[model samples]
Target: LPSAGSSRFAAAVTQHAPAFKGTAVVNGEFKELSLDDFKGKYLVLFFYPLDFTFVCPTEIVAFSNKANEFRDVNCEVVAVSVDSHFSHLAWINTPRKSGGLGKMNIPVLSDLTKQISRDYGVLLEGPGIALR
Candidate 1:
């Protein structure tokens, strides 16, 4: 999956973003997150290749660190990957020194079944991983 019609990073083709709801790790705990939960607000949704990777950690950390700034602008940042929530939590627990996302402020949704990634048009059929 690359994008529904023309969604790119912060731009778009359609006004409506794909609908999704799933288990997400928020503040070190598992919680249900959905597009409806952020209804009426600008959403900054990004999909990374996977957790525990080089660029992935940097991207997640950057988004997490800027969560407040995003909130001030009435936007909620969300990161999604094909990994499970448990994998996300483990990666979050791992320190940056060890090449993992120390912690994340935003909800990290798990697209374990790859459905979410597909919906977002970022899943690679061959590798079964989402593109960043």
Candidate 2:
């Protein structure tokens, strides 16, 4: 496994295998998406701790608020977490007033198996979670 300090890892991964195809949840719906889907378009791929949490919403909303800015730059935003697709839908359906993500215009990939997180070297082994 690569160390968290390996900044070169991301570059290496992107260089060797830049695109990944997978199933993700968007607007409370399950759909298939791929890195190729954003090809020819810049992207903002972010990771968060969990769905209904403190810092998570602040960042999610902040990104959502500025999503158009990213799009203006010909970019798309994709978020990820260890939660399942069901959990993602639940969060999306939840109201922001109750600490949920509300309706987001971006795809939130569910790394349920944690393989993606591990391959990216961001997985927190002890807790079976990933560091955002």
Clashing pairs for model 2 are none
Per-residue alpha-carbon lDDT of candidate 2 for residues 23-129, written as tens digits (9 for 90 to 100): 68876789988777887887777777777778888888788878888998898998878888888888888899998888888888888877666656667878977
Residues 1-132, candidate 1, lDDT per residue (tens digit)?
344443332234564677788999999999999889998898988999888788778878999999999999899999999999999999989988999888778999998988777776678879999989
Candidate 1 minimal-lDDT segment of 10 residues: 1-10
Lowest summed lDDT across 10 adjacent residues in model 2 is found at 1-10
Model 2: residues with Cα > 4 Å off, grouped in runs: 1-8, 12-18
Q: Clashing pairs in model 1? A: 1-121, 1-122, 1-123, 2-121
User: What is the TM-score of candidate 2?
Assistant: 0.83
* Global local distance difference test of model 1: 0.85
After superposing candidate 1, which stretches have Cα over 4 Å from the reference? 1-11
TM-score for every candidate vs. truth? 0.89, 0.83
- Each prediction's RMSD to truth: 3.4, 3.6
lDDT of 1 at 102: 85
lDDT of each: 0.85, 0.76
Cα-based lDDT at residue 108, candidate 2: 84
